[model samples]
Target: MLVDSHCHLDFPDFENERDEVVARAGEAGVGLLVTIATRVRKFPVVCAIAERYDNVWCTVGTHPHNAAEESDVTAEELVNLSEHPKVVGIGEAGLDYFYDRAPRDLQARSFRTHIEAARRTGLPLVIHARDADDDVAAILREEAGRGAFPFILHCFSSGPALARTGVELGGYISFSGILTFKKSDALREIAKGIPHDRLLVETDAPYLAPVPFRGKRNEPAYVAHTAAVLAETIGLSPEETAAITSENFFRLFKKVQRPSMRSA
Candidate 1:
């Protein structure tokens, strides 16, 4: 049983035939799926999916690309929205210097605000860092200074230094389909060193789908491919990779209430 720790089933890419998309996820052995958030103002859409699926959960956050538009967001609003049972975490939020669609300052502040909200709420912070490794690590270290909160660096494609920093900070590391790419030898090596207890897997679907499906629009069902490559990368059986990562997901996202969470 695999758990895709991060995905976006709420996106329109799966809109017309979401039932099939979800059914495919189950058929692929994806036992649990977490629908991530990109816009807090539009959270009702994300929440509706989590509320509908017994095996799905969600988060409350604004992606860095929308930082300027949602600059007025407060931790209180995130906290209030996160009180729902299905809302298990906070933010797919973090620095994204690669795009810079949002001002760096706004992104940093929004990232910290999500961190603070996670600290207050006792929920894991689902982070998204892209070409902003130093800034992201710095902010996480600084926030940890104030008070340590649970966090997972999702869809990680950065260097080993960032991975080490996250592990040293007692945070979790999640790899996406990017790891299955032909040029991801270095990433595969880095993933090999991640402590199994702190390692996670995600699809980040409708985005970086793994090889064999890389060019197509990704869905939760493809997470199994990522898991297979990760297993081969780490020299474990695919079944073991599923069990280990699923356990890591539950350990990191403790607030999530899934039947597997209890078993793991």
Candidate 2:
């Protein structure tokens, strides 16, 4: 079974049909989903969605776009909020120079705070890096120097340097629908070089829907399409791709109880 390791079920895009969206994922063989949080203030909403669906889980942190708004959020707060059984990861937070929605310094500060929470809580940090790979890598390296913490480079679309740095620092690289785009040859080459155990697939849904469904609103169900492309990219069958990514998911998000074999 596939695991959509990143998505936003709490977004208004799925407000009216969240149930149907999740049902479609299960029907499509996506046995698990993690509805990532983009704001700590709205965390209860995100957590509620996870609580409503047995197969769904969540993370807690402010997105880089909202870093200024949640600038005062402390690592202690993130650790406390993450005590919920449904919260399995931390931060969709990192540098987003592409958007520049918040001050870069604020984004960096928030990213480090989330890292601290990850270190304290042992929940994997769900990092969202875009157009700021160098700074992101610097922060990651500096933070790793402080102490090792598990993390996933969520929705990764960065250059090879950051990809190599992430894996070297013991972080998993999660590819999204972008991996299936026709022009992502360089990204595919990067994927091919990644070690099998450190690879993962996600949809980052309500955003980049994989080929054929491109431009359409994405959902957990479409993760299978991305998985199919990843299988081809790495010379594995669709079933093998699903198995390996799912295995990687559980290994990193250790708090999540693996579904029974029968469930798959």
Instruction: Give the winner by TM-score.
Output: 2
Give the Å error, residue 89, model 1: 0.6
Reference-based TM-score of each model? 0.97, 0.98
How many Å off is the CA of 62 in candidate 1?
A: 0.6
Q: Write the per-residue lDDT of candidate 1 for residues 18-90, one digit (tens) a residue.
A: 8888889999999789999999999999999988887889999999999999999999999999999889999
Reference-based lDDT, each prediction: 0.91, 0.96
Candidate 1 is scored at a TM of 0.97
Instruction: Show how many residue pairs clash in every candidate, following the order shown.
Output: 0, 0
Q: CA lDDT of 23 in candidate 2?
A: 97
